[model samples]
Target: MKVIRFVLAVALLTTLGAIQALEPAPMERFFIEFKPGTGAIIEAGVRADGGQVHHHFKRADALAVSVTSRLAKRLGSDPNIVTMEPDARRYLAAKQALLTSQPLLQSDPFAEQLVPYGVELVQAPLVWDQGFEGEGITVCIIDTGLYEQHEDIDSSFVLGGHSQDPNSQWFEDGDGHGTHVAGTVSAADNDIGVIGVSPGKASLFVVKIFGEDGLWTYASDLVAAAFTCADHGADIISMSLSGSSGPGPERKAFESLYNEEGILSVAAASNGGNRQRVFPASYDSVISVAAVDESKLVADFSNQNKWVELAAPGVGVWSTVPHVSNSWLFTGGNAYQGEPMEYAPDGVVTGQLADGGMCIAAETPGDWSGMAVLCERGEVTFAEKVATVMAGNGSAAVIYNNEPGALLGTLGEEGGWIVAIGIGQQDGQAALDFLGQEATVQSSAPVPGSSYEPWGGTSMATPHVAGVAALLWSANPAWTNVQIREAMDMTAMDLGEPGRDIAYGYGLVQADAALQYLLAKSTE
Candidate 1:
């Protein structure tokens, strides 16, 4: 009788689980408040109603106002609240928002290598033109959805799972991360900017796991999304979210999916720059990826621990962003005066141009005649300081970066006259010193075909691995996920302690080496 009942229970659980998958799970409510004068306000949750408020005494001229139990009592009811730490929630919220923003993308200006500029370009060698370009592969990118109209990924969106509550197809990337991930996995190779590892190859499954504000509904949402990815035929899944470790239903769900369905899951080890491991990444089944820089050194910020399986380029790495060009730079000035300026010779500067930008030029006083020359940086916006140089009778502008930091500024696209360029701070300072107040610039050789563009971070690193995975899978369709993983690990050029250390993990992922390894294993 017990045996029959156990079988019956298992059957019922599976049936109900399928039904729940069709509905959006219930969400808990949280509150937030804006820190005054910071221009950043909490996006949702904490509001003026029954929400608790803390007064900033300096902003107000009173001693201490009388405490009201009403707000205190309301806060007490919710367990999610009233753990009552200091007002550190503000910092936590800001960090999350910033992570969701393009911090890494903006950091690319300082990168010495060109690979980090975008996905297709960086991982091109990993892509193979042969069999099973991830055909029928459903990769669920549980992130902000795609722009829906992106030329590379529009055709890959399919609707196998829908939320009963909203009853709509999930196909948009609200934070831009998912779209970039999708593009790396299987963006069609249509003679565009860069080529995906699997061009015209795989089916990308978009799973909206983040909120509009780029926060999660719950850690449980991650687990649920994984199941949906599984049920919807996702052969391989990649997630770039990790902070704290989690267990309970989420962990159980992941184990079941991996063990039972033979699904391959890969995740970011983390960018915390410490020995601490983030959950899910630290989990046993998922492949946790650390990061390496251009010199093939481990990224200083990538998390390390026993769980890290491999490393890839994370520093100043770049990938595509919707509404942003594959190879484009934004300026901080308007083109109201004349045409935009050009760049200086390679190794001329270190950083990028700021708001009051500059156009770097090759050679010296001769090239400076038609272009508003941008110089290197010491302090202030390279563009701003470069603008001072351009004022001496050049047409448009010049930009450079300081010795240590990358230059970042918005482009002023009102007209075509003023072109702006932000450079590295280290390079900027070099230019400034070289030119002496105004650029008494010297002539030099033509610019190399390889100059740096701006990009940054582990968010950048994640897609490199994704693209590499595509290439490996394409070369040998019969190789299992474990084999592909082994190929990457074995082929990676070890950079750390001679044997898998934290700073470079297994080493830099070598595309040709990985392909050779995969092919060799296939023959074996």
Candidate 2:
């Protein structure tokens, strides 16, 4: 029957013949085919250096193929028959050469140089400790779905991972966004990778709202997902996805959650290089998170203006992955597909492969050895181009903004492989400019907290707050959603010029301080 349908469809196309062939009624747009496990590419825009332009095409094969063919034909012209994607790859390779090789965490031994001053770690062996170790708290990660099997995340008591639409298979995230956010909020304190903000034990309800593909999701789905999370007993909903132009059904649904269930919602303020606010974040009931650089300055690309509730460390942070085995072994797994990923130095492999593939040490710079650079998006799209170069790679393949702007994105997997890293506009431009010159590639150890590493955007920052939020909620079961948000705001150490500046928002989230405040208030 399926074969007959295909034959009939082809026959129908043949009948339309000259008209279909000649007029070409917009071939369904072709999209970058992302390999499974990688997160969705939610946004793409212009790059720096004025060397390239980006335009998004809907995920329709006919349209995408038509656009590509046309572009290819256009490239076969005089001033150098060329395609921008390939040019971008070459440009990225050159750029990787100029980067200073250093692991993000290992750089500058001083805490001041690495960890932000705002981060005030709770001293070991507590002083008047509030017992808010998030025992019964439930955080709903409303992005991609969660991976129940991840050792770090506790699914044992996961009330349920529910979805809005019954027909929508999008409840699960093939993309890595939701899981990463979930890890931050409530990954169990299993001796695995990094711990969650709310360490110890808690519940994580995977409330998926985004599809595997598509630039923007229907507001209806978002609304349904939120209501689903609340209905499933979600105490706090941590959302890393964002979009502007709202006040739609989704906003109404979110309002209902706040009014009826008293569900607390947190959203990314967006990574778009503008002050405009994104939805959910812009919504009155939700807490909006902005990005902060190492300098404790608001990331140049992080959305600003009013509507922001707080700020967290958004620059070059790290966390857990669902397929810990695959990611740890550098198997190059794609979180979206939820499959075991294997990475051969090339496409194919020969003898016994090494456990955990070679990782481009964070912050450590090197000449890209014709490999793809993996980067997170933000700052400017050009930052992706730059990281690819500095990583000593041949191509740039960036991930989702991870902040608020656009949470899912795709690599233009047209020519060679792509290298990815999240970058801001200033750094992106600086790297691109460096690519134009003949410069020696720099090298150094990985900087643990600063330098060229995974950082920037609400995506990176959301987990930190989520972890802290978890800790606070755990310590104080009686604290309301509003109360928790208030405590986080009140206890934050101011980083910007006194009071609440946009850069640091109310200040850096101090987990221990918040715990103490909540405990003291409980006594009163």
Candidate 3:
């Protein structure tokens, strides 16, 4: 009877889970524009059909509203209205991922200099010695809200900020994307935490367009935010959010910001890897940035196209986030792909990996002396597994998930255990092939402080160019935005298929080189 009841409960839970998964997403919205002098009648038509106006870009004659699909079809035929474009949500191409650390690793990154490799790669330090530390230059970051109180970027945030979502505060960062981008742009030059590429007097004006959890916001919202960037007297606008294509109104806003106000804009080339045309970045007014890694190799995920203008370090790039993340892993003279166990003791352990057959046995056949036990998760408590591995004289434990996801399981309560790391099932299984190989686990709890983490994306790459722009522009405040844009292109370290190829753009953006380009141009 117990068995039958258990089966029934499992089936019921599965059904309930499926029903929850099928819940509806938010309804679709559209961006509509009216022909010249037809706004009054077109708006009336929209209201007549149950459409609710959300954003009205009065200057550009555009209205962002929620309308039924049937109503959208009907509104299209109205002669007074121009083309109606769906208000697509542009997402942050930047994401956080722990890589295998092969081409991305080094011998103790913070040994000599604590600066991120991307900062060094762009040669920001060389320019800083010349007293061009991004002073008098302001960069506007348009994304999710910024975490105002982060230790690195507190004083740098300027003019407060505006949020499209009424509920969220511009200073509140539910998703750390904006905070990470801001840190990369202008974290304080203090000696403690990670410093930015332009770690100086450069100011940041954040415009929050997306809500707390949603990693995306409407193109209309982004358009509206750009104007906010301008209203605050921004010199450089950095856009890390992007969609497949943008509406005519959206394009008009960016063009106006560039052509009229003369604000220099940098954006991430979409991470499609395909040759798809990425909007906003593809716009002639904005400089499109592609992503390369520490090795200067173009990231495979970075979109390859002629629209790409400049390249910057994007893979395994470290900067600030809202939370604490300091634990790391390395294996076999390479950076390993794994995370330290949350409750594991603070220390580093390097040992030869030995298979331990689920690691739950009260006793094991072979001695695990000074070896890291590789065990699959199941049966016993995480503490018991580690205890058993230690009983067998193992130096440490490397637990892997039994299912699909990453095994972030704890050792329950702490004991005198050595370093232990939890990796996903795939990485664990792959680790099985090399049984005798050496793997190092560095584990530490988030006790004191450490708000920085490494992330990957063209989204990460955009801010490097933006920060470099701030550095160059601050050095030469009198230069126009066009001159700043043109100088980077002219001085970029050309890579890939020669001059201005798809992958590397002109090449990896060089800060010192751009300064030289401006100086040489001045002589001419």
Residue by residue across 1-524, what tens digits does model 2's lDDT show? 99999999998888899576776333222212222222122221112211122222221100011233444344334132111221110000000111222223322211112222223242111311444556687877766565555555566746667654344443344444555566556545544444455553667777665554323454434555676777788888877767656633345467777777878888787777577767777788887887775556677767776787788767544443433211111222212111111111122111111111123334435454443333334343333334344355443332322232112122322333332332222332233322323222111112111111133467666656765676677665677877878888898777767888655568767777777777788789
Computed on alpha carbons, the lDDT of every model, listed in order, comes to 0.50, 0.48, 0.80
- Per-residue CA lDDT of model 1 for 1-524, tens digit only, reads 99999999999999999999886433222221123332112212233442332232222111111123454445445444313211211000101111111234333422322233334333443445334455555566666555556655547444333331132235544445555555555555654433455564666666776643455444445655676788787767777777664543345456666777777777777777788867676677776777665566676777778778777766654333454311222223211111122332212222232223332322224324433355443344334444454544454344444333344443322223333444445444344433323222222222212122223445556656766775566555666777777788887777778888765667667666777777776678
Question: 125-165 in candidate 3: lDDT tens per residue?
Answer: 99999999898888999988788877777574455788887
Highest-TM-score candidate: 3
Whose TM-score is higher: candidate 1's or candidate 3's? 3
Residue pairs with clashing backbones, model 3? none
* Clash number by candidate, in order: 64, 83, 0
What is the descending TM-score order?
3, 1, 2
Candidates in descending lDDT order: 3, 1, 2
Model 3 spans with C-alpha error above 4 angstroms: 1-28, 101-113, 325-450
User: Which ten-residue region of model 2 has the weakest summed lDDT?
Assistant: 88-97
Which number leads on lDDT? 3
